[model samples]
Target: MPETKKFLYVNRKAPYGTIYAQEALEVVLIGAAFEQDVSLAFLDDGVYQITKGQNTKEVSMKNFSLTYKALGDYDVNKIYVEQESLDARGLTLDDLLPLAWEDEDDDWAKKDSIKVVSAAEMAKIMEQSDIVFSF
Candidate 1:
């Protein structure tokens, strides 16, 4: 693989009743397929992606939540969650996507994080990206 360029997909909305989440997920997966270095940082309501125990089937909707788990298969290894968003929603790290992480890997509990991030920190990631797509 050549030196892959970094691409960041920022998911900034809820996963239901909107195409933002779905589209963002698509870009991330396909970007990886092209051999780009794809990473995702979920902020604001986007943290819902990692919310534990979702059952959208009650609303007669297909469960896209599990699609998040498949990110690794596409080689999208960087997934970030904003800590303040989780707290603002009264959600603990425990109530988030099962694959949460920290830089130090304190939990090592899942394949991905429970990694907490901040807006400014997210901006740093954005600045470093060869392409930044926000949805």
Candidate 2:
């Protein structure tokens, strides 16, 4: 069997304003198809990618908040939001979308997709990654 490698995508920008977040997500979606162990880290302004109540109507852009929710369906469920990042922006889990995925190990039960961790903790995760894509 091919060894499954760990892939980590580091997001440090806001969802809009720039294309980095969207492009990173697209890469993650494609990479997930390989069944590799994938994880996403939302740091700095990147935490806003999952922020709830996103409306792009005024900007004439499609709301992609739902895209984050759809990630679970692709089995890309390991989303980590940095605590310091959220605190710095005065945001909380309540301000983010509630993303979940099916846990086959738990008899296909649904579980939350987001994991809030400290910057230090996220660094540890980054260290374990076999491939790290930073945006």
Candidate 3:
């Protein structure tokens, strides 16, 4: 059998200010189709990408916050939120949307999908990954 490579996508910018977040998400979605082990780390302002209650109506932009939710259906369920990043912005886990995925090992039982970790821990995850993509 072929070895499965692990991919870590690091997002460090706010979701809407630039195209990076959207583009990165597009890449992740595309990559997920390949069935490689994939994970996403939301750091710095990137934490806002998964935040709940985003209003982009005034900006005339499509609100893609819910796009992250679709990742679960694609089996891209490993999402990491950096605690330090949230703390630095005066935010908490409550500020973000609750994301979950079906547990394939448990007869499709729904499981909380986001994992909260520290910056140091995120670094370790990056180090352990076979490929790391940062935006």
Please give each candidate's TM-score: 0.82, 0.95, 0.95
Sorted by TM-score (best first), the order is 3, 2, 1
Model 1: lDDT of residue 96: 69
lDDT of 2 by residue, 1-135 (tens): 589999999999997799888888889888888999999999999988888899899998778778888898999989999999999999999999999999888999999999999989999999999999987
lDDT of each: 0.74, 0.91, 0.92
Clash number by candidate, in order: 8, 0, 0
The numbered model that scores best in TM-score is: 3
Better of 1 and 3 by TM-score: 3
Order the candidates by lDDT, highest first — what do you get? 3, 2, 1
RMSD of each: 4.0, 1.2, 1.3
Highest lDDT: which candidate?
A: 3
Q: What is the lDDT of residue 90 in candidate 2?
A: 99
| Tens-digit lDDT track of model 3 for 24-89 | 999999999888999999999999899999989999998888888889999988999999999999
lDDT per residue for candidate 1 within 1-135, as digits (tens), equals 768788778887988778778777777766776887777888889988767788987787766778777776565668877877887889887876565333335453345533678867777888999878878
Question: For model 2, which pairs clash?
Answer: none
Q: Give me the runs in candidate 1 sitting further than 4 Å from their true place.
A: 1-3, 100-114
- The C-alpha local distance difference test score for the whole of candidate 2 amounts to 0.91
Error at 103, model 1, angstroms: 15
